[model samples]
Target: MSTNFDEQQWRAELEGHRDHKDDFFATERQSPIPADQRDAFDGLSYFDPDPAYRVEASIDPIDSDDTITMETTVETEQEYERVARLAFELADEERTLVAYSGVTQGGDSLFVPFRDKTTGQQTYGAGRYMEFEVDGEVTAADTVVLDFNLAYHPFCAYNDAFACPLPPEENWLDVPIEAGEKLPDA
Candidate 1:
């Protein structure tokens, strides 16, 4: 696929998802925003889509069967099966992020939660999340698109009622990711 066309398509899809979430946050009963706060909610903030934030990453599958327990905002721990590590280049620097599968949510999806230098400044303080679907088992040969422009804040960033897993030190990036969702101003 053409790079320009692919980026355009990806951005359009991201905008659509943002609009849907805005609607839910404004009118849905299960919205993370409190009922009283929803009245003043305009929409979530986001950085303008930039193609530079999209990069191709190679998967490095972990051979061990060990599981990682991540701490949550509620002081609880959640277990995830360590599936693979994604290595890519961002901001002219090489970086790696651990990818996981929910221990109970099955292996159909890969979850990547991370914190960047922008975290607690331009983006959510707790961190953001990205998820991808795995077609069979992910291996070293797998090349996937890692798009920071699609990074999104966890629900806990909006309301305290929702508990979100904190990004481990392994997933913290030293570079600022000026893409995707920004912290909502209250």
Candidate 2:
């Protein structure tokens, strides 16, 4: 699939959205949680969903010329030996190779927090993310898509009220991912 990321268009959209910080607050004030559901709101201390872009996939197909989804797997705790052996294989100076794994959410969704190489300067200091589907019951046992291009901002980064998940240490990537959303002021 071709990535149609128009830098100028993205920059303009980010800038335009940044200007409406007040509108985000205004809408937040209008949204009320039920008394019984207060805990659900508070319990959502991490990765609160963005009201604007619910869980709906973009109208674009998954593998359209516009966007594409790749598939990979995460090693489960049960596979410690295999993963450990792989890690040892990857303990070299110049380079290393191993079949790594990560959990995914989508069809039984999982939230994998990540900070790409672009953290702090290009993208949000907190981080960005990619979503995927896990096939089984064990949350950690499944396939993942390390699609950097699909990374996106946390709602809080857009407006203060949204609480987003901090990427787990394991999910941090050491490469600069010059894709997805970048700093609005960049």
The global C-alpha lDDT for each of the candidates, from Candidate 1 onward, is 0.86, 0.40
Clashes of 2: 7
RMSD of each: 2.1, 13.6
- Evaluated at residue 30, the lDDT of candidate 1 is 91
lDDT of 2 at 51: 24
Evaluated at residue 90, the lDDT of candidate 2 is 13
Write model 1 residue lDDT over 94-185, tens digit each, in one string: 89999998888885788999998889988988999999876666863577888887798999988888879999999999888898899755
Estimate TM-scores for all models.
0.91, 0.41
Q: Between which residue pairs do clashes occur in model 2?
A: 72-144, 74-101, 74-102, 105-109, 105-110, 106-109, 117-175
Candidate 2 lands at a TM-score of 0.41
Assess candidate 1 and give its lDDT.
0.86
Clashing residue pairs, backbone N/CA/C < 3 A, model 1: none
Cα lDDT of candidate 2 equals: 0.40
Worst lDDT 10-window in candidate 2: 80-89
